[model samples]
Target: MAQVGHESHGLTKLEEGFRYTKGISQIPVKSAMREGAQALESARLEALRGRPEALADLMYGGRMGNDEPGDGYKYRGRGYMQLTGKDNYRSAGEALGLDLVHHPDLAAKPENAARIATWYWQHNVSQNAREDVTKATRAVNGGTNGLADRESRNERWLQTLTPELMEQLAAGRIGRAVEPPAPATPARTAPNAAADGVLKAGEKGPAIETLQKSLHALGYTDGKDRALNPDGHFGASTKEAVQAFQRAHGLKDDGVAGPKTLDALKKAEQTPLLSNPAHPDHAMFKQAVGGLEKLGPQAGFKNHAELERAAATLTFEAKVGGLERIDHVALSTNGTGLFAVQGNLNDPGHHRAHVNKQQAGEQPLEQSTFQLQQDTQQRQKLEAQANPNQTQPPPTRAMG
Candidate 1:
């Protein structure tokens, strides 16, 4: 009978109360209310038998007696955590500046329902010292009716809410703010960086062997029975492996180990294993696969999280097009000057575009810092990604 009123309640009324609990005691507001809502749902389901009238009567039976035929329906519980009875309706209405008594249906509105549920929790259960899940559940249920189910749902929600979001709830701050996971430490491959030049099909050397070993170690396979064998030769098998690695690590999928691709492979070797592989906010690995796309040509990202991920993985390298040579540009962690590239000064146009986009009054790369400066102090701090032990040359001029 209790299940009869399920249609009367909606998620809007329920979810909004997740952040409210102003007067509740020491327990974190979100945590407490989350349990409260889960417990209410459990009790509601348990009490549901068959008859709609009986369900309403069970929920509001204490307040609305047998004298009225439809009193239970008129003042039944409705909200994320369910606000019931005439007295609660009156108090909640007065507090929220709405006449819930005359129009009891208003309490079913998502916003009003959320406010009333939180108000009930802040006043009724705020004095309970026992923070045990069952104790909190009983505070709302009038008894520990669905303690087990409530605890289970509470845990599931806790895992879903990030600590940063929990902090906001604890502080009674409103709205949502998601923080990205911390980046893994940058890792480098074997020390043979001398032959770091671009490698294509048919290329053979220790560098090719090194690249093959990296792809196999990092679990990027060549679409065969297993990872490619680490022969010092770059063949079709090696190209397939390179492309797979590139796709996974947000790089261009050209299958050629260019300086940028080599840099990514080295950094990928260092990524730490994540606790929850399925976490929603895992770095957007496929953000610009098959090429840096908008993120490359010049280095930049959509947000701070992306920027940090890029900083930990990317390095500057000059590339040559059909007839013209493009200057290499890499951004610093602090959003400052690019690292000094070997042939950056040769292309005056590229140099001016990168060094000071805002000053030059030209459109810069997408999602990258446009202000360029030759800050000597900042350049002094820059270290080579390939060989962090050695210091690199300073940026002579800004590039776009």
Candidate 2:
């Protein structure tokens, strides 16, 4: 893995990735004595892992082909073990149930590399032909680059198989590369709300245009307003367009146009619906995350970031685990030199976030501010329930 990363010109962030060199996924370069192969020890492997080059090549080039292109880091050095090039991907994927063609990123991830490394050793590599090992490694580097010549590949393959090296490779330091498990999805939330067909005032933007196109494509509307509702609006015409789409798609007659409505509209339009990443609605992520449930550990993550290279942002302030009710929502925006609040809000996680922040020498943990926010939000909710006409107040956060 290290060799690949070093050779590939991975950035600092990429270098930190476990799938590449400089991370757990890297193959530890060992001492020359152990590199040539004899029964090796675990610690020996650990030490090898630190050196950029272990085998016969650190000084000149590590143990590469006996002829030229001798093993160093150019092609067949780390993780894919000896596999490289297009042919390597094709042959390896055949044995691994992976479509490496589209997902080349899979090779870099640590979990997959470990699984594939072992599988290759057990199933494909053997003692009968040391030469075949060389060819396999050579094929991986560049099928055409070395294979077209044929002569060099043949000579190298004969010397490539060193029993000691085979055993070392078999040690499983390089895990059998395989796809990682997926992340678990949060449960679906309450049904979503959308305006009914015949757009009202307010909702506007390219979104409305998108909706209009969807409605027209699905044959929901035959009018000229098919381009997009102008003047940044989801007007009466938009509402009617949605209704036309809904009825055509066979859905319940609610004025609001939601996901179901959008899908039908997109189908009608015959264009892909837009999914903006900058504003990820928690709803859309539900399905994909759910599918990832069986893949790996998730709860261990406590923040939106990993403080290092992580495949995905795993941290979200956990839902405030505990709550208490209060009669009044209040705030002291001036006291803490920040807008501070007091009242009930699920405040446990808020408390923890503050604690972690302070301990890490960041901003002081400000529970009081969060408390005020929670209070304000609660007050608003209460007013909404008590008198729908009332402008809702902000939520509060308890003091630190």
Give the alpha carbon lDDT tens digit for every residue of 160-185 in model 2: 65554566578753356644546758
- Weakest 10 consecutive residues of candidate 2 by summed lDDT: 307-316
Which portions of model 2 show Cα errors greater than 4 Å? 1-82, 122-124, 129-400
Worst 10 residues of 1 by lDDT: 364-373
Determine the backbone clash count of candidate 2: 71
lDDT by residue for model 1 (161-270), tens:
86867777898774655566588678555344346578876556688888888776554555331346776766656776787666655579888989888887665555
Against the true structure, candidate 2 reaches a TM-score of 0.18
Best by lDDT: 1
